[model samples]
Target: MWAELKKGAAVAVWFMFLTLPIMVVKVNPIEQTVVWRWANLVWLGAAVFVLTVVGRYCSRHRTELSAFWPDAHPLLAHPQLKRFLLIVLALLATLFPLFFSSYQINIMTTALMYAVLGLGLNIVVGLAGLLDLGYVAFYAVGAYSYALLNYHFGLGFWAALPIGGLLAAIFGVLLGFPVLRLRGDYLAIVTLGFGEIIRLILENWNDFSFGPSGIAGIPRPGLFGLTLSVDDAIMYIYYLVLLLGLITIFVVNRLRDSRIGRAWIALREDEIACQAMGIDKTKTKLTAFALGASWAGMVGVLFAAKTTFVNPASFTFLESAIILSIVVLGGMGSTVGVVIGALVFILLPEYLRAFADYRMLLFGAIMVGVMVFRPQGIIGNPRRRSYPLPMAAADQEVGHE
Candidate 1:
């Protein structure tokens, strides 16, 4: 009886949230830029409400529900049903832009960049167990690398993409060499200092970077000599980001399961044990740093094109922290979890227009809450094997390992 009530309530809540897209009103344009869709806010609210109700209901009638019927749970012991639900979700994500506006598509682009960045950071913090607080420095390097190279050399935006990644990888090696012996707080502090140092240089070095004023008019990405700026530019960027995001997910997943990836996990689990087992800690660590930085670099190129500008403000310690939080909150080492976390973090605040001023406050609170209640993060583990597995197991299996 209680299970049925829970199910009814859950369905009701889902309907309410799903209706938000058609109900919520937006008064301010700025608020709309980063806010979540009405439907998403509704869904989030419904999820929270249903969870609370289910908790109370289960606490009160735990035995009654368990005894009333062995098969009372509709979603239980039915793997196919779960798979079907997941396929629906994947379909929704792929088709979301088809139904959204240009403005919403732009926001989605930013979210995709965050997703890519989160994936990159996962290598350093999640896989290698390195606390890098200055990851944004590399992001800056990539953006500026592309910005300077494209503007000065008259290179194509497409060409600048990999060049930026290469530049970031070089700096990643330089940073790794010096900080190889540092760990924990010491490593974090150094990385933090590194970010500050880069920002200061960008601010003061007017001749090269044009100082705090920023470099403007960076080119947009193109395909076969055709720029994505015409027609639905946001959609074009979205597909580009999606393709890159998928590739990154695949690469990370493969690496995590491969020999080098195993070495990274061993190092993350125990440096001493890794050393004893003859894993080249130094080389493995550097590879993680380089790969992590390379992703940031690639995203930087995308960002520069997206914004058509590059400045120190774009790559600050806060940006690094937010990216790191996505990795941590999504469940480090879990690609799907990180991607989901990125979506929520990027989209939730955009939808909360009434509480616009409290965006950062809520962000901090959510991070703290997740850390306290779900240390393994919302997805629940670094490895996908451990879970609160999604209702649709087969659909959930679509991404990287």
Candidate 2:
């Protein structure tokens, strides 16, 4: 009883530390805002105390609670039902723009964009076990490549999309080369520096990038003889991104089953052992980086086209962090997991817009809670096999005996 009480008290204190700023005190001096709403702190603290106690109970019973998903996995093996569910889901997605509010559709569009980014980043971090903080640099490279080519050279969105991807892939290879010998924190720091460097260059190079002022009036995408307009643009972009996201899913799923994918998984599991198995480390890593960046680059063009603007601010480290978080939270290397993570990360915040000021705090709290409860992730990688041999190999001992 005493231990539970102590734990509850501690949780209450922690929750107060996290939510206090948003719960009390308006600190925006620019609008001459200085108000203290301190009374609610007590109520909030008490509520947190009760919730924390209940959370402790849930944590202790997590295995029991989590059994439902394990149970459902067998049901998923029914092929016809699985296909039927998938078709239904796809049909729902196809009809989303027709039924949902424009605002929700816009949110889904953003989610799809992140899903693509997350899938790309998963190639490096999940499959290859790389820690790249400059992933957004490729995103920026793609966005800026399209923006500049379209702005200065009069290239259309369709024409510039592949070109942007190629440019980003080149940058990815360049990044991969310098960090070839690095790993873990060192690699992460280098990538972080690279991302910052890219942002700084975009911000400082006034003439080329137009500096902080940004490039505006970017042309929107269109079908032949149909220029996308404000009324239907979100829906069009939704379908566009949805198509891109599906292709990404298919490609990534295929790659995960391919020889290259096997090499990547081996590298991720044990680099030295993978090297001993004759996988070229440099080439493999570079390919992972290049492929991931290409996805981001392709989507970056759509991002630029969607917003009709490209600015250095849009490609900050925060963007990379968010994308990486989606990958991590979703279960790295799992395409469906990344998609779920993106939708959860993006849509949850939007749903909590009523508590706009506390959005980040809530996010932090939720992430902490998730990590504490599910260290692997919301959808972690599957358990590995106990033995890496065929049944024949296991049975060979009998013959020898």
RMSD of each: 10.8, 5.8
The segments of candidate 1 whose C-alpha lies over 4 angstroms from its true place after superposition are: 1-90, 227-231, 382-401
lDDT per residue for candidate 2 within 1-401, as digits (tens), equals 68998999998888888888898887887898788888778888999899888888876887798886552266666999899989998999899999998888988999899999999999999888898999999999999998999889989989989998999999999999989889778999999999999999999999999999999988888688586668598899899999999999999999988999989889988889999999999999999989989998999999999899999999999899889888878877777778989998888878877776765665566657656655456666652323446865678558545
For each candidate in the order shown, give its overall lDDT on alpha carbons. 0.82, 0.87
Q: Give the Cα-based TM-score of candidate 2 against the true structure.
A: 0.87
Minimal lDDT window, size 10, model 1 = 68-77
Please identify model 2 stretches exceeding 4 Å from their true place: 10-37, 69-72, 383-401
For each candidate, what TM-score against the reference? 0.75, 0.87
Question: TM-score of the candidate numbered 1?
Answer: 0.75
Clash pairs (backbone) in predicted model 2: none
Candidate 1, residues 191-226, lDDT tens digits: the string is: 889889988999999998899989998877877776
